[model samples]
Target: MTDPAAAQAPTTVLGASTPRTPPARLGVAVVHDLVEAIVTGEVQPGAVLPPEGVLSQTFGVSRTVIRESVKRVEEKGLLTVAQGRGTSVNEASAWNVLDPVVLSALVEHDDSLGILDELAVVRGVLEGSMANAAAGRRTAERTAALQHALDHMHETIDDFDAYSQADVDFHFTVMEQSGTRLAPTITRILFDRARESSRFVGAPAAEALRLTLEEHQAVLDAIEAGDAAGAQRAMEHHIAEAWARRRLPTARD
Candidate 1:
């Protein structure tokens, strides 16, 4: 006879219980701290981490936080855990460096690597096809968007970070203009991976940025002209030059 909502309310016994709140996440922050330490080799490979209770107390957080943090590092292949034993750091090669978080950690410590060359290889194949398709299929709106990104690149040339971001945008616009899901998806991944590696921040070697902007113009021109072959060639050449710049040997030898 009672209303369902009222009937469903808890009937508390004397001094029975209080409601519980879900634990807060100290996990992500804890994991990031450990990741930085590991990547920086402060915690050497095969080193065992302090026990969960110790870590929880040290960080003034719950054991749940410590457990979740360990789990995250394990997922990144940076650590291995065994029941009743402890967690141990893994070798650098074992980590998923392509994972954005891991890549950010790695790049924070060491910026001199050819990681961008690998990224450029993936972009070259996928983006070249996208450029060709865009040349054939681009709508006027999409072409204008691409041109706008190129213009922004020129405007931002004095700011390496801004120019790099605009460069990424220009490439992404070309992929989107292709009107294909796969190319755009791959291009996004490639750019994201490159950003994580922090490979695009420095002023590219003198003339490199200028050359890239010119190549971008070439691709835009071909796309506007509806010359599919020219667009594809221009895109391929741009990617090739990018890879070459990224792979140029250091003079430290």
Candidate 2:
């Protein structure tokens, strides 16, 4: 990873002695543009990048900036640099898809490059299990907290941003109520990412919002009844339905 301190330092051109104050976020800007281009297929894998001199000219930055930016991409598993062959973009399969940078770049792309489908799988497995575990730990206080979030959802149905925050808090609260250490932390990151992209998989339509409430209510019901298997199944169904809704060209998409 490029150190923030180093990124802030004045960058010297390949042959120059004077330290030049780099443009604001020069390295990060270069990395983001190149990542979007690659992930969105404007630049394909196996294609060789132009030489650093050309990249510097193209981005209108110093040679040092180009190098640092390229280094950032390479570190993220998007590019490979060779002494004699220059830099080559790697296939998406080879990239570190789980890295927050890579995931955020994909999310920020026009359509997430279809990575949301993959996220659905991860959520289905992890959250379903979390829900199952939560059943054993469910208490009146925990149930009330979840119902409070759900109530917020109902009241803010006309406000998507508010509803989205409530939705995030609802699921993250579920994980916490599960009495697990890692699940909440892992889910917190993914939930925030999905929320940012409007990919939290809910909407304000009467049907959509009602369905969300019903689905969450089902999970809460199962937990309140102390049915681990039912809670797991309910959560799994909710996740699958959410994924299906997003796959369509509907508002949730």
Candidate 3:
């Protein structure tokens, strides 16, 4: 049986991955545009925003709209406003790492993929805990569901598109089995982010996919045997290796 300590892992996934766009709201549009600009490096940190009049005219909105929009990003620590200095972008160190807007902005608008390493680290931690939690509570049905995904992964190995899609489902199944309400949303976001940044892979054009399949099977074996720590460690090791392949490029994970 899995030890109770395995259940002690946190229920929440820390940090978030790639972003798409913010919702539609009064000031949200402004927030979206400004954040995109900053993240894309159109506006450097320490540089002042255009004058309110210029912004209002540029976005074709009233000054009040511009002010409100600017306020939202400021609240997220993406911008600083003052009596003399106007408003300026803050350093990356000052931004809120968890806000979806910030997260999306930081990741979505850039080709450089500045935050990939950080995203991988947090993803590793959350997925590790999720595997541990799932192991402690694995049911016959869940095991079969996992098995099904793995089988699909193996069968589709020669086809990158099919295999990559199955790999995503496999990960989603792992989080779903963890019995966490937030897992699906968080995992999907990460999956989307990974695709956005080209990190989600078929391990195409290389042997990367086959290696990941083996690592995933190790995770499944540990879970079936009710070894929570083993399951967690396996998942983390897979993520670390995956990261080495996705991020480093030159050195194999």
Write model 2 residue lDDT over 1-253, tens digit each, in one string.
9899866765323223343344588887778777877887777899898888767776778899889988988998999999999899898888976667777778777363366676777888889899999999988998898889888888887887787677677787788888888877676666567656765454546676668778888998998888999999999899888667655463444
Query: Per-prediction TM-score, please?
Result: 0.67, 0.78, 0.74
TM-score-based ranking: 2, 3, 1
Task: Please report, as a residue range, the 10-residue window in candidate 3 with the lowest summed lDDT.
Answer: 11-20
Pairwise TM-score winner, candidates 1 and 3: 3
Q: Arrange candidates by lDDT, descending.
A: 2, 1, 3
Clash pairs for candidate 2: none
Angstrom error at residue 241, model 1: 2.4
lDDT of 1 by residue, 149-171 (tens): 99999999988878887988898
* Candidate 1 TM-score over all chains jointly: 0.67
- Candidate 3 per-residue lDDT, tens place, 77-184, comes to 989999887998899889876677777766665444447766677778888889999999999999999999999999999888888889878888999898877755
Alpha carbon deviation, residue 10, candidate 1 (Å): 57
Candidate number that wins on TM-score, 2 or 3: 2
